[model samples]
Target chain A: MTRAEAFSEREVAMCTVARMVENGRTYWAAGGGTPLYSILLGKKLYAPEAQYVTEDGVIAPEPMLPYEPMMTMLAARASYRALAWGTMNTAGIYSQLGYMDYGVLNTLQVDRHGNINSTFLGEWGAGGRRMHGPGGADTIAACCWRTILITDQSKRKFIEKVDFISSPGYLDGSEGARERAGLPRNTGPWRVVTPWAMYDYQDRRLRLMARVPWVTVDEILAECEYKPLLAPEIQVLEPPTEEEVQLLRTELDVRGQTTDAAGGWIVWDGEKYIRGGGD
Target chain B: MTTVSEPATIEVLASGTAPYHKIDPDGFREWVRDNKQRALVPKLMTEKEAVQKFVADGDYITYECNYLTRGPNSLLHEIMRQQKKNLWIAGKFTYVDVGMLVGAGCAGKVDTGFFLCTPSVRQALDAGKLEVYEYSNVIMTMRLEAGAQGIPFIPVRSFGGTDGFNHSGAKLITDPYTGQPTVIIPALNPDVAIIHVQQADKFGNARIFGTGISDVPAALASRKVIVSAEEIIDTEEIRSNPGLTKIPYWCVDAVVEAPFAGYPGTVPGYYASDPAVVMEVFASVLRGAVEPYLEKWVFGVNSHQEMLEKNVGVAKLLDMRKRETIRGGLRA
Candidate 1:
């Protein structure tokens, strides 16, 4: 199959998420996988001046160090501004300093109200599946002007309500819910980007905004546990363009960190797009 | 003012709801008010003395370090060798330090952002021998910041929706001015905080390079701060580079000069991490041979110098240092 034909669900999700990010906005990204790839793709394609800060507060702009040992080593390099703990203690403080404009987070579950869950699934401790703790999701969700959630499309994940709210979205779908919940008036999840479709909050309720070219509104609704409000202008999401695919291959996925269903890393080695390893 | 009831014994809950771990806020307030008048002077000491003098059994201790950088390994080794028991440890993100402590049975409870999935920690948690409390890395820092600022609690926006919010010691309070619900995390105020840095003066004004992580706030939040430095420079050097200083001398109780302190973990401007050794140690931990690994590497060697010479060897150390030169650019 051709490279474009072989575009994986993850790549599509990442590209779609990347397109939503505005250029030159400060972004705080949490969890690896698709969210990290999306931020890197956004920086490479459009958000060149985007200030990217890791959860631990390592701010590095574009022409950034290569991933892997370099990202770890360069994290401690003097050039990376380590905003001392006091200034960047909470996500709210970081947002107040104009550091966090947008956030891309990988949540285990996202509810209709946009509340995210990444902490625990069933019971607390041994009985439950203990996921990674909310690193800065809570803080960022509380203050970032806009937040984007990237997760796989599944009935189990798109639930009526999250098992636990790890990060507040719009609580109870009320007008002043976020303000009442102590979150900044302007801050909340703006987009819920999944492989099958995209969602947004309107009137503090989950609304289907768009769907992948292959999927329909019926399919999207069938996958959600709660009945979702349909957007007035629901559109079909554009597929990954050639340039987007190329950037994802060469710059972002050079290490072949993420893979497709066939267990291959989609790579572009100057001449053409190839699957599996990079040049 | 809400009065927190003092429990007969400190109960460390694995998870569930607010006040997961409790301390009498009134008692803490009285203690802080009394101790605030005490003057602090930096005492130059050995890692052994610093660990022993400040860290007590069942004390809540925080290591001001990140996942794989400036981990205060020397102090951790000393604590391991001494085998201080029932200690509650906290940090932003812990890998080796937490792993070793849990493996050695020194850590009774952990309140941390992130911890490595080591067999020892897993086995302990599964066996119900270890109590674990979770927080996001930034929230951990916020707790420390509140402690440093001498505040009862700080209002935060995050964790309102997570299981951590339900299980945390943080309280949900309405903002009087805005009538908005905000989560308020209580001050941590660890009994002792151990930090490793790039350089420090004899008086303990220390500077760290690379990502400061939560080190500054951790140091400031502790009752006693012990700093281990790769180099002990003159106070004049610290004065010259004032902007780089993360922990001032007033916050420091003791300073120990220990070169190559964060071995295996990199110290930014000084050395690159020895990934091979780190991987080997982790492998050994996963294989349930942590005792042998700790014996040969931690206790069997008398000093960090001996550990470097006998365990890591000069050639491997030299090679790791050489790799840093190529990777040492501000921008790639």
Candidate 2:
């Protein structure tokens, strides 16, 4: 549990997300990659009582060890000892029934209002690069009580406004806008986990609440295209505990696809951690 | 820090101008009643025969579940191999299946919720060779349910604030009970529904081991169901566990015993997905060698069995089966 351990950006992001999973709460970490690692690691280390579900309707799936990296959310090889096996109907109906407490989503681009887009880059019809349409993020964002967004932090990603609202956030950043748009009241974006920091919605606007140990407030702000509202006291997150790092490396991400030191979003550049890696 | 602009309207206009692929519920119901077979006869056939007989040109078709799970890859390959023209596809949470279909020029229009926009699909879209309609996964699944129930539309609570709502056939309707705005998706009765299952009786009493992701509803909603299974079990075996039968014989029109039907995909207790094979196919697609890849795998082979023997050897398939043995003991 020592803090004097070198951690990659993925470890920081995964741990931050893991810490948010409350015990006994039900969560659906929508996509694979880091979001998958976060919930699985969270269940193992932090919230053992927390129930994790897949979009394919497997509830509380005890994922197999030595994780399979290639497979996404419907990873049969990774899932075993599932409490209940349902279908896409179960996933959607449960969420509508308010059973899904937390929904972690992966986004390609996010805005200051927490509106995220994983659909397209530019204007959707005018020759925008189509980055696969939303699978369940729209449903999760629209139905789940609380939503946590995860993505890498960069000027290109953290935009002033998303090209398309693939999922609902604080629509138009106005109070009661989500209700007006027919989304359930009190169910919207809750927190955002990124490589450099974590954010929460303040008055329906993205407000930076915490930063990783290595990064400064200026550095995070510099990386964002939009100026997000800063928390009154932006706490610096402690470096991941040695055990947390070990669990991620040896158990969840056995292939080093995500939590690897030399691969993924941030890397050790001899003297300091820097961005730009991963295949 | 730059000053933020004034908050914009919550309304999002659809970017694409493609017309929605709408089907008249009454017309579809009458057609299903007039065309579908109600006899309790064995509708056994090969993939080629099933696709040719049931799937026609310009028909709206969808498959059960998705490509990663119990995807009907053999049927899709057969559709491509036959070059079914002007076909419309309904893709819900699909990946390479839609891409391959579009790339092969079999399908021209897609009603999709989550389609992987491959370079080939993108090229087609840019070239005006393809049309895509957007919806959420839940809405699409619910549409199938609506279709199965012979309903015109079903009201839902989501997809209002997003851009997908603007592009889809779904409409924001006033809830009669609460007077609140609600999203209602139309019924989707596909012309043909191709499904792959672990086991099925000769009369198309199918049993899927894993999650039945919209298969039953899709089968019931479609005019025809082409079922491919790992094993053709006896009716007595199906009668032993009547509860496990997801798609009943009445909805199914053809039964094709095709093992490894969901190749490069998993079939729960049968075999684990072959990621290397999927990666290789995707890589070939990215390199613009879709034609060569298809020719080597789908078009070149005589049947799914021959394709398996030629492309994936028995040793590799057995290894996948061994990897999937973990689920055998766990399933009840």
User: Would you estimate the TM-scores of all the predictions?
Assistant: 0.82, 0.93
lDDT of 2 by residue, B24-142 (tens): 78887787688766777988899999998989999889887666666898998998988999888887877677888887988789877777787788889999988888787777888
List per-prediction Cα lDDT, in the order shown. 0.70, 0.80
- Stretches of candidate 2 exceeding 4 Å from the true structure: A67-69, A72-75, A259-279, B1-18, B328-332
Model 1 lDDT tens row, A132-168: 4566677777778888998777788899987767777
- Recovery fraction of native interface contacts for candidate 1: 0.47
Give the alpha carbon lDDT tens digit for every residue of A51-78 in model 2.
9777778888777776443565455655
